[model samples]
Target chain A: MSATDELVANNARYSEGFEGPLPLPPAKKVAVVACMDARLNVYGALGLQEGEAHVIRNAGGVVSEDVIRSLTISQRLLGTEEIVLIHHTDCGMLTFTDDEFKLSIQQDTGVKPTWAAEAFADPQEDVRQSIARIRNSPFVPKKDSVRGFVFDVATGRIDEVV
Target chain B: MSATDELVANNARYSEGFEGPLPLPPAKKVAVVACMDARLNVYGALGLQEGEAHVIRNAGGVVSEDVIRSLTISQRLLGTEEIVLIHHTDCGMLTFTDDEFKLSIQQDTGVKPTWAAEAFADPQEDVRQSIARIRNSPFVPKKDSVRGFVFDVATGRIDEVV
Candidate 1:
């Protein structure tokens, strides 16, 4: 069966016990931007539930224009006031650089895309950069409430990157 | 205490019993891109475990350049072979037009963002568009393995968008 087919079957079981109809806004009024790594369960790790917070995931959890876009809307429209950025240890983002990756992808597919890899050497430093990016942006409300952390993939421990 | 203070406190309890050391690559070899809606639990809804799949999320799960960048790395560097694009009903993306929203943000913050909201009139159509974007991108490998879905926020049912 297709992988999605398996997900569909999984969802059948999930919806059989689903309890939703949650409000439009997050109950805790926070938005979390984290990595897309499979091992890091953002909700379980951060103690979030279905109606608690908006969890935004991407390659490295780095702050990009799209992230800012989501944050702007999340704060302005949805009443989310706090922002948390979480990058994890042993991230695929730490594996390569933009130049080398772009070169490699070009070699692999004969296309030099205009996208930025947003790769970083240290996850903590990347978290710091992401926090600074959000805090510095005028669009994001409640900038002082922004926090950054590095979640250890090995231990599931989240350490503040201060 | 602050909102994040609560998360930090909650996480302390979570880490005490945390179990991990999962591998860097996803066991299921698939990446699921979905919305940043707080009501949706990407992991639990799809029955994905800690080491199962990559979950990339943004405002609308729209296929942007950065998403392609991540998917390229996910497929080439990591072993992710299938891609799933999930958009949800009653999404914030269905709330406004890019033109009006950009004007509103510019008025609110005195800065004009170059980013597009990628908003859509319908969730299913947006999912289809996202799947097509991933399939059309030169960077993404295994395009034929892509699928799309519209997850119902109220009932927690995920219907295939085909």
Candidate 2:
């Protein structure tokens, strides 16, 4: 079976023991922006239960336009107040540069992507950058407690990026 | 204490019994694009462990340009083969219209957002729409196993969008 199929089977077993139908808004009133890295399990690492927080993740958790869009809806419509941004050690985004990646894709497909690849050199620095992006956006209104963290993948710990 | 502080404390407890970093690449070779709903716990619902799959989430789980960018990197750089698109029942996206949401934001912020709010009326139809978007994108090469599903928040069950 494909991995998707296996997950579907897993879901079937999960539903048998599940108790859900939580309210629409997040219980913790926080929205988390995290990396899409496989090993950075946001739920487990943050001790998040189902229906506690809104988890928005992307390639590098770099606070792109889409992330702003997500956070706008998260705070405006859903009433989340705090924002958490997570970038982790040994991220795939740290491996390549934007120009090189876009150029390689252009070489193969004859079409270069217009969007910023959002590659960053350091996870801690990128965490600050992501926080800056959030603070600079007028669309996201709640910014009092926008904190950033760099998760240590090997140690499974997160240090605040102050 | 703030909710962010509370979660940070929880992370300390989580790290106490945590293990070393797993491999960077996803072991399952699959990427899941899911909605950023608090009720839809992707890890628990899919029985996914750390290092299993790349989870990309947004407000509505719409296949936006950023998603294309992330998937491009996931398939090209990280070697993921299958894609899973999940939109859940009772999603916040179902509550508003794109024009109305943008207009409200424009009124509040004095500047309109260029990005689409990506609100959809139905979860199942939106799932099909998201699937079509993946099929149409040239940037994402692996499309043979692109499947879409609607997760039921009440039942914690996923029904494939066929």
Candidate 3:
């Protein structure tokens, strides 16, 4: 199916009928930091619902500058108190070398790359490292809880990494 | 069950003794922008496997500063050539007025509120707006595809929003 068709199909299968506004929950303040891998469904894996947690995702589920900023806002501005960082197994971020990725893009688009190399290496270790970065980051409330996990995509399981 | 128990259960159910590392398809490099709402399971909804597409998530699935940064890296540095932004219904980001949220937080934490009225507002509209922002974003390749949708927490479905 075309991308648009796939989207529409998925939407039709998953979205229909509900029209009213959502009733807010009392525990409306948890956050999850997860990878951008489509295969790892954070909700189904964790058995969560809307308003139960705020999710933050990026490459490797690493706590980058953007994660810190959103997390800060989620906590200070939106009232979230807990954060769960979820990285996954067999991640693409764990696969290609920077040069290979750049070469593929260069061949596909013929455009010169602008970003540096250190950005895409060792995704698993990156997740482990991000946990420490987030824990030590000044932006996150010192008392706020932060935990890390690795989601095994094949098994629909998550392992606490830190 | 604890997270570890869940992992163990899933592993027992799904893992075959093939042990030489799970064989995965070549990463197709798609980007997914989804809500941090724990209820929306992008993986199960999409039937995705590990090492498939990249996922980017934030509040209301809104594209924030960090989302853009991640997108830049995903497209320019990583191999993603398409983007899917997934928003959802019944999102907490839409549930309360800024003042109400601040009041609730203040009452809970007993901290002097430094949050602003502009902090909280319409979530559905915000998600649609974020999709537009991403489509028009200079960081995203013009020819690279970008689409937006809304996942219904009640129905476990997603609707194309833009």
Candidate 4:
């Protein structure tokens, strides 16, 4: 069986003990933008219950146009008031530059991508960058508590980016 | 105190019992594109442990350009082979139309967004849309086991969209 099949089986097991249908809006009034890193389990690391916050993630957790779109809907429609951004140590994004990654893809496929790969040199700096993107966007209205963090993958701790 | 502050406190508790970092690449060789629904805890519902799979989320779990970017990195830079697309029932995306959402944002912000809101009438149909996107993308090379599902929020069950 593929790994997908195993997860499906696990899903069956999860549903057996599940009690859900929580409210649609986030209870904690917060939204978290974190990297789609496999090891950075946002729920576990943040102690976030299922209905507490809107979790938006992507390659580097960088605030791309899509992230702004998500956050706009999260705050405007779902009533989330605060925003949290997280980038972690040893991220795959740090391994390559945008130009290199796009060039390699272009060489392989013969077509260049229009979007930026959003690779960054430092996670903490990217965290701040993500925050600034959120702050600058006119789409997302709630910004009183927009904070960023660098999660220590080795230690499972998050240091706030000031 | 702000919700962010409370989550920071929770993070302190999480780190106290947390273990060191696991490997960077996903162990299960899978990447899940899921909706940023507050109640759709991808980890709990999928029974995914840390380091198992890359969880990419957004407003509607729609296959946007950013998702393609993330998947390209996942398959090319990392080693993920299977792709799981998940859209859940009772999502906020269903409550509004793209035109309505865009107009509302334009009215509130005095500037219209270039991106679509990605609202949909049905989760199952959108699941098919998401699957076709990955299948058609030249950037993502591995497409052997691409699957889609509609997560039932009430029952915590994910029915495959075959």
Q: Per-residue lDDT for A1-162 in model 1, tens only?
A: 977788889999999888778887999999999998988899888888898998888899989888988898788778999998899999998888999989988898898979788889999888888988887888887786888999998788899988
- lDDT for each residue of candidate 3 in A11-100, tens digit (9 for 90 to 100): 565445333334333144667787766566555566554445666787667776566656765776557776677777776566666677
- Fnat of candidates, each listed: 0.78, 0.92, 0.37, 0.93
- lDDT of each candidate versus the true structure: 0.86, 0.95, 0.62, 0.93
What tens digits encode model 1's per-residue C-alpha lDDT throughout B21-76? 88899999999988899988988899888888999888888888778877887888
TM-score of 4: 0.99
- Candidate 1 yields a Cα-based lDDT of 0.86
True contacts kept of 1: 0.78
CA displacement after TM-score superposition, residue B76 of candidate 1 (Å): 1.1
DockQ of each: 0.79, 0.92, 0.28, 0.90
What global local distance difference test value does model 2 have?
A: 0.95
Stretches > 4 Å off in candidate 3:
A15-30, A43-54, A69-82, A88-125, A142-145, A151-162, B1-29, B47-51, B77-79, B95-120, B142-144, B155-157
Better of 2 and 3 by DockQ: 2
Candidate 1, residue A76: Cα displacement in angstroms equals 1.3
- Pick by DockQ: which candidate is best? 2
lDDT tens string, model 4, B95-153?
99999999999998899999999999999999999988988998999998999999998
- My TM-score estimates for the predictions, one after another, are 0.97, 0.99, 0.67, 0.99
**Which CAPRI quality tier does the interface of model 2 achieve?**
high
Residue A146 alpha-carbon offset, candidate 3, angstroms: 3.0
Q: Over the stretch A15-134, how does candidate 2's per-residue lDDT look in tens digits?
A: 998887899999999999999999998999999999999999999998999999999999999999999999999999999999999999999889888888888899999998888889
